[model samples]
Target: MLLVPLVYLVIALAQVQAGAYAAQSTAIDAARQAARQPEGAAARAQALGELHFADHGLESARWTVELSCSGDCARAGSRVTAAVEARVPVPGVPQIWGGAHVPGITVRAEHTDVVSPEES
Candidate 1:
């Protein structure tokens, strides 16, 4: 009946949401860890490489690392932000019944820091 479809829809939404959150959590954690490193660019690169979340029907892309600094960036003189995008797939069954087409979901994560010049 109608109630049966409602239950299925809720479960599907929950799954996609959970995946999005997991991706965001991983990206944010890696970004924070990278910022805490004094190596600046090198650290950023490492963070980008390390950020990842796995999904069965979702495809994940590489993470982006942003640094707020000028010159050599030898010191932690600014903030940092990292973001990653993911496309989660929703099965066609739910979409056909719900007309949701909930075919894809995107997730992004960001982290900021107050870097001090002397924190080099």
Candidate 2:
């Protein structure tokens, strides 16, 4: 019987790990999409929209996204960076069923993409 609870815990932990991986991938995709857009509010909005679309069962309110550019952003050699952080709630077995109280985990991902001068 004790093994059953342990199994549940292991499964819950695995789910959390998987969620974190998914969030990282989402962030990378958002960054890539944002880098392709012009540097302005429109680009930011586009990135956020991508993040929202790629969210892996995470609460949007708990997610933070940042976009930045270094060097001549409008130039072909410039780079755009996107950072995403989120606190994901762990889906664990019910506590009433003798499950452990597992706190949430924070996951973050950042990606940099080169900008093409021709793109505006």
Candidate 3:
């Protein structure tokens, strides 16, 4: 009845919230890790390693991270930015219903950190 749909809505909302929080944390952690690295390649590698979603109930979510630099990433005082995007599928939704596609919530987050002088 009405209660079933309401429960599904609540579950979808909770999943979206969890995905958003995870994306934010991932962006922050990736930016910090990249800022600590000494080169662009190393920074990207470190940042990719920090993108963890399983613990946040986003294990089945599609997610990706993009990194950018203000200038030379290895240079002191430069800024490293990490952007994370996650597509979380809505729960209790049929993959195909009346030609309707699976609904998903897109969560995004960005964080920036200055490259440490000591790392340069």
Write candidate 3's Cα lDDT for 1-119 as tens digits.
89988888888889999898888888888888888864564455334534567667677777788888999988889998888888888876677753235678898999999997882
Candidate of highest TM-score: 3
lDDT of model 2 at position 52: 61
Alpha-carbon error at 116 in model 3, in Å?
1.5
Off by over 4 Å in 2: 39-55, 59-61, 93-102
lDDT of 1 by residue, 1-120 (tens): 799889878877875776567566655664565556646544654444444344433333333434443333344555555555555555444556443444565555555544455532
- Candidate whose lDDT is highest: 3
Error at 88, model 1, angstroms: 1.5
Task: Please identify model 1 stretches exceeding 4 Å from their true place.
Answer: 38-52, 55-74, 92-102, 116-120
lDDT of 1: 0.52
Per-candidate TM-score against the hidden true structure: 0.56, 0.67, 0.81
- Considering lDDT, where higher is better, how would the candidates rank from best to worst? 3, 2, 1
Per-residue error (Å), model 2, residue 21: 2.8
Weakest 10 consecutive residues of candidate 1 by summed lDDT: 56-65
User: What is the Å distance of residue 75 in model 1 from its true position?
Assistant: 1.9
Global lDDT of each candidate: 0.52, 0.62, 0.78
Q: Which pairs, if any, clash in model 1?
A: none
